[model samples]
Target: MDFFHGQDSLSILEWTLRAAVTFIFVIFTVKIMGQRAISQLRLLDFVIALMLGNIIAHPLSDQRIGLKGSVVATIVIIVLYLIGVFLSLKWPRLRKAINSTPFPLIKEGEILYKGLKRARLSIDDLLAELRKEKIEDVKKVALALWESDGEISFFLDPQFEAITPSFYQLQTEPFDLPQTIIREGRIDLSVLRKIGKEEEWLTHTLRSLHHTEVNNILLATIDSQNNMKVFLYV
Candidate 1:
């Protein structure tokens, strides 16, 4: 019994070592792979991620397999991934084979049933995604595309879109972008400096507006027109 217990304790220690090594190896691999490897993953990248999870998990729990084997397997997977990325960048045909192209879900205020069927998306799912974008009526949409990454991009009809000064043939003066001076009860010194305004000036301005405490302000902005907008916390 003592011999078995000693073996189990040694197994536990081995497992810990395996987990730690695999954890560090995965982190290093992700860093080398770059952000797009995880984020904005295409179908091929998604499959690889799933397979890699299974590959890493097996050695992590199994004490009989050596950590060196897991490390080697991981490195091999990363190398193949890098090679695939290079090929995808160089060859458009190969890229198309690995990742799906965007499909039109709607065009000219009309739902494309054929496109929806090809994407394997139901009307309810499409409507839910549209609602998330605050689009309730389908007629208001001029074009909607189901992106390769499974996101829906909406383009409103010209009539429904917000009218800009350009529509009226107006010559608008170029202005500086608005800078946030305060956000979430905190003063942004970088934004203050960017707007060429000093901290003392802000304090004085706030005081002039009967705002004695900066923390009391929830949000503040200085627009290109030199208009200072302040919203206080309730």
Candidate 2:
């Protein structure tokens, strides 16, 4: 009893051994489960991970439970996880039931309130995701799907998408994509250099626009068309 309560050599060694074994087991299990198990975890995979964490923690903290029992428990979890993966692959209905279907957040630039409610997401949340995709207006999106992994995939309307030179049967020189040179009043020197521009050139341009300081600019970018767009602080 005293040995279990105290931080003695035997107790330390036992805890260390338990943690090592548990870590190795978890690593191998994850390796066998493949990248999808950790990257794009579905509901069943998420639940199994949570349960496995608790099961592993029990033996690590409890001095009474031995390593053999912990190993057996972990193996059982792995087997169940494999079975779940098999079922999900073999049966479409079971897969849909386990992972759920992608929710249609936006269609034809219209927000689906019912889908938002079902996904437990608010209008603001969807707006934030849209902003992350560089979309200023939802009207530009033809379709938006809320994936099971909680990621929003956007499909832009053909009218809102950029037209290629080939569409007009015109030959154009190769150009680099637009990169932000300044964001929120901070000058990105690396981006400036990447675009074949210098700090001196940027400063001169700002002077021409009646702007003296880089800190006074809110946003600035140069497009493939060699056009410099600038937004000043209000």
Candidate 3:
């Protein structure tokens, strides 16, 4: 209770309690902020993350700083952040201002010097970004843009693009993601039902074809064609 307000002196247990309470409070605050806060650090998200961290961090280190004030400040900051996000969505200009427009770094293998200067990215940095994408030759790039999230997006020229079956006018079968029917020796009944198969059928098939028991299997998946792929535990 003392930790909630300003504390003059504290024991080890009080400090520990403060840490645990602060940790849970921060987690709860972040949960309300949603996945976007952690997954992407756009301008608005960056500001929210920075403020929340600083506000909550002060109370953990200093006994004079109260958890009560920090918690209230965090709530207020999060509400403002959410409001900012909503307003940005409603207004296009605000969105553009918060998350600036992408800068064109390269176009048809030609470097845009003006854009590089505007984005404050050096030639070496651009080269390093290109190298990270496994693009050694700048001439092969059709377009490259500096994204708002400080990441580079590169597109290879049509002629330099990787060959796919479609390029050869070849017909490819439709893709169906394989569903995991069994994992760690446990049958996923929901998946079995989704695939229109019964546990008895899966058991019999494994015994007849793989000569293995369900308990010995570590993982298994079924494709659209009823093709069962099984991997036994090592």
**In lDDT terms, how accurate is model 1?**
0.73
C-alpha TM-scores of all predictions: 0.68, 0.54, 0.70
**lDDT per residue, candidate 1, 1-234, as tens digits?**
232233433444453444445444554565445333454656546655865797789878987766654565566666666777899899999776555567789999899999887667789988988899899899999999877666778999999988999999999888667788889878999987777888888889889875567889888888866578888888
Q: Write the per-residue lDDT of candidate 2 for residues 77-185, one digit (tens) a residue.
A: 6766788689889999977766667878899999999988766778988898899999999999999987866577899999998898888999987866777888998
CA displacement after TM-score superposition, residue 177 of candidate 3 (Å): 1.1
- lDDT by residue (181-232, candidate 3, tens digit) is 9899999999989888888999999999999998999999999999989999
Candidate order, lDDT descending: 3, 2, 1
Better of 1 and 3 by lDDT: 3
Distance (Å) between predicted and true CA of 24, model 2? 25
Residue 33, candidate 1: Cα error in Å is 24
Candidate 2: stretches off by over 4 Å: 1-40, 165-234
- How many angstroms is residue 126 displaced in model 2 relative to the true structure, after the best TM-score fit? 0.7
Which of the two candidates, 2 or 3, achieves a greater TM-score against the reference? 3
RMSD of 1: 8.7
